[model samples]
Target: MINKLSIVKLNPIIIREDRKNYIVEDRKNGEFYEMPNPAVDAINLINKGKPLGDIEQILKVKYPNEDIDIIDFANQLLDLELISEVNGELILKEVDQFGPTGFLWIPESVSRFFFNKYSYIFYISLLLFNIYILLTNHHLLPNYKDYFIFSWMSLNILLWLGIGGALLILHEFGHIIAMRANGLPTRLSIGHRLFFIALETDMAAAWKLPSGKRNVLYLGGLCFDMVAFACALSIQYFYPTGPALLLAIMKILVIDIFIRFIFQCGVYMKTDLYFVIENISGSYNLMENAHHYIKSKFKKEARKAGEAVYEEEKRTIKSYSVIYFIGVLLTILVFVFYSIPQIITTMSHSIDRLSSPLFSKPFFDGAIVLVQTLTGLSLLLYSWYKKYRLKKE
Candidate 1:
């Protein structure tokens, strides 16, 4: 129970997330806890040496009978480790202010070239030309599976993985560059979203930027991906298949990158497009509200949650709930009917290749098979872990 006399201060580690919300980062455990806007404002006042009574009085004047309990809010912040008590008073911890900007830091100097608006226009124009050439030359286009030249061998898969990994790095750079273009500093790190390992750009700071710019920043990754796919397509138009292996590589790059591009449309998966819609609609809590609204249709327990949502947000959430439901249903159908079966088949085929008599004789080839098998297995396990065990960290 934080009382009026108890002096409290905001933990410096608790970052102001977006334009309207806050999130506390646990440096020790790599966790993020989102905070409500009101409590965050009170913490800001508290950090300025205001007593709890003063904070309560100020909030009372500001909100005017919103029934805000500063004491309870401050207690919650304490429980969340967003503020710490030191000798009857909360104190802020001093840490390196600009240290550890996520797993991969993008310094301004190297990334400056990417932030240029003129360069974006050039890149887009080139991509459009590439796409035009690709669409018209349908006869030269290879089948998607034609890229699997060695029947899922380790070396071939590794080549594809290397290309995909490089593209992912550029994809993240696109986000950083876009943020920098808007005169915003960005931090990025490697993190997980369910079963997927993802690059997290700390766009929480972008909340202060115009919503239009923020939306473009959210799309930066896709922008890079499109450029990559275009480059691969361009190569296809020039080489056409004279080099044999070049065609396979280009086809692989084109196909894989395009698939990843489509992955952005996965609203149920909270992909980039989801954030775009959320930001564009000004519904910061769209996902949470949408989940409740969708659930309330059939689940009695969710009715209160649906009711608790703000009226303005409810319209956006309700509309989004329908889209969310459709997206989820389609994902389930695709995974259950095609994706799971294809994976199982690939694993079986890989096992057969590894168990062959020739595999035992040539150590290198066998090693490749082993790597491919382990990679597949690791992804499966990661997916399960993400769905069942992973949370916020």
Candidate 2:
């Protein structure tokens, strides 16, 4: 319904400049779009109350060589729900905000208290203390036996699951608080990264801030993990003669923290550390570009990654491609050498235990493991459905 003389009324929007594109976000529902220079110019003119025809003429003059289609651009804006009205008639589409809402009450001061320079110094010092503690007392280092803290395998599995679930909440809380401190709201939800189920913070709004300012949001979870690790080590060091169960719990936490830290290094999974690297390197599409680079190596005519960007991005993409390939290869190797064998051995043991008399210790143990396995698979499937299938529909 847009014509040359149509005066477009745009919905309220917050526009911020990214490195090469402008981010146009609807203020009400938080929907955003990344637009290049020309499109952004049209938007700016629209904001200034220019008629669609005048905006088209201005853009045509700005880019004389390119085909400037004002009607097409206006239609695209309409599709995005950016256009509230044309010729003063309401054409706005109401949209619900994406993700879980209601963290607006969290004050920025709380974030500053937790994430300031002095707090980071304390965290770094604590991490160093932990390293010293481990080095001096080699027995403090993580051991596989730590996983079997309880007498019953089922109890031990449940213990880890309970503790891990709690810690995961803490980890995600770090992200939420950091985002809130920056005056941005975020929500946590289940997501799948490859074969793993992960809790993710929807911080897409963080892009409104400068890349340098956003690193803290990415590092927030890992920071909490580091602090948790240090606290566990400190408890073990100071309370040598503490209650037996408390000491055992600390030992379990120590190993869990170690595993969590190592797991975050899995850049292929887009873990916290991956975002840190991405922010530092300014490789906004590192994973996608790396994928393209890897694909190009196998097929000659494959679309090259980072061809249009600066040389620095190209280098980051090339370097990450190598890391991505090795990471994936190592994952496959681990699955073949460790995970598969472990799953098979656990299943075999569970089957033997299940053959025992009803209500016996062995039967209960096997039943617990089976339940845990099924629960894990169910969660994985649910995560996949939520992330991909549900989104598509």
Candidate 3:
């Protein structure tokens, strides 16, 4: 177990330097560790094929006043499974690769077309066109009634789920494709953001990219959402009296896109917009820091909390606290004004339909509603458990 002569072989590591610390990333698993100068120097020596003894001597000579522990640092790396081998023996651990699983067939050149400077211009143009259409054709703006396209509640729910699910996939695909274009790995997963279930792209590896490049990746999903909304609006604008079924579906798409946009605006939850803001501001752990800052205000620990964050990030986090509260207020407003009313109306209608004759259409619709409600509650509870209790245990 002694390590004076131990030669450590490391797995692929990518180091990114921010204002405060060196973010040492285990590329194989997308794990990151914040390390100080000494630790980073030790890592550099290890990469240069220097034995542990040499590393210790080098670090000790370099930082004469500081107490440096190369062996302990190597052990920490070992625990993280970043060590690939020791003196010719394999030490790397088996773990799931969190890289791109789909769309590998698409070349980087092709995917890059979507995020190039010109594409952003197109995205903005389309967004403006959609706004113009909405302003000119006020009737096309989504109303709450647009959500109830079908007479049967269950049918409407099924239709929306089908279309919304597709849109969600496209939204996530935008992120995935953009990531691949940047020669990075990411995958889509489901997670809860407060009361909502969202499809998210795991872009932990994105830290390797420059902050400017990462903004494109972060905004990828929203860009696709805007494109979809614009396309649907354009079609409806040109053919106002199109086939009834097609027009009805377009109306549902508009409502789905509109709600999703509003949902992303509530950045208190980890939305795509939140990542963009965090990336552009160069603020690490903005969400957690902003949260701490807000709590500290009431407890009079604002100074302490402020000190805990990086010096460069202090001002940004303080400002972000304001945005965080605004986002929370937006969520509260949506919950009170839209969600509560929708829930009450749906439940009341379902209960009334449940009283209808057995095996009738109304009774079936009511049964479907009950099942849907129970399923949604189950998913929400499961998400909460997975996020909190399961992780601790």
Candidate 4:
């Protein structure tokens, strides 16, 4: 038990809010802890160096009948790193954000003016216009030939890099704008998510927001991507004689962005939809619990088990588990029926390029091809391995 007579204190915790909840952010550790209103009141009092006994007495007098265990409450905060002792000791554990490298933090006041509700209205209008254009001019959509008709080198790669880079920036900006609209100061960072490098946002502030607004933060990126594709398609339609490279670029954007949008539905991938489902169900550990349900039902690891799966999240997780299973099955089918063939075709093409003696700059081209082949194979192996591991579990 914490000493009732001893001093308790709040760390450098920043209290913030959104539509649904209050979150106490311990910035020193990049962590946020959700708190009830009473807990928030107690913490703020503790921040001023209130003693444990005095804080409990104050809460008892204020609420009269509520059972307020200030010691246990403070202990929980201590566990979450939301509060610390004032004895001048240093923290020892390692807690890192996804990517803290060369982080770019735009002050909210600087960008808040640009991200009001009107901005979303403009995005929606542009989206509607794009839809109209697509209906009236279906001929403008890109074809497979558009991708390969170019030199696919030098300027081609440069333009693709530039455009794709800009799109990704806009994508991250969408998240930043969403946070700003919700009155949160957001820091955008570049990070490595597993094997792939990505630009990510610090939406820890998002924990305080309502699920509706939380989803806005998630959907914001795809909005930018779609708007970009719509613009690219419009440009391609107006200039049939426009650089074939633009067509190639349009094709690339369409394929990449659409595939990415679809990929987000992979609850197993911990995509945006995964969080959306979690928020909708009010279960933060939905996927983890879903797997637990799977284990119990399938008797995979439960053969040695006797305890029941906790029901706190069972109803929500069971429904989610079914969807999760469907997503996994679809992903497996996609890999087996589609991805393997594409990988083989690309590998064959690369092999032929490497063997073609008359090809200029064969070494440089072969290196790129080898990297592509290796990446594809690595992804295939990882996917199967992950599936195998889950089955074993």
Among the numbered candidates, top lDDT falls to 3
The number of residue pairs in model 1 that clash at the backbone is 0
Question: All candidates' lDDT scores?
Answer: 0.67, 0.79, 0.81, 0.64
Q: Write the per-residue lDDT of candidate 1 for residues 130-154, one digit (tens) a residue.
A: 6677678875454445446775456
Ranking the candidates on TM-score from highest down gives 2, 3, 1, 4
Residue-wise lDDT of candidate 4 within 349-386, one digit each (tens)? 55666775654665456557677546645765665666
- State the lDDT of candidate 3 residue by residue for 290-325, as single tens digits: 777777667766757566654667788878878787
Residue 75, model 2: Cα distance from true site in angstroms:
2.9
Clashes of each: 0, 0, 0, 1
Work out the TM-score per prediction.
0.75, 0.86, 0.85, 0.68
Candidate 3 wrongly placed segments (more than 4 Å): 1-9, 16-23, 27-30, 34-38, 49-75, 84-100, 135-137, 300-305
Select the stronger candidate by TM-score from 2 and 3: 2
RMSD of 3: 3.3
Clashing pairs in 3: none
lDDT of 1 at 133: 73
Clash list (residue pairs), candidate 1: none
Off by over 4 Å in 1: 11-50, 80-110, 123-143, 176-212, 329-367, 379-393
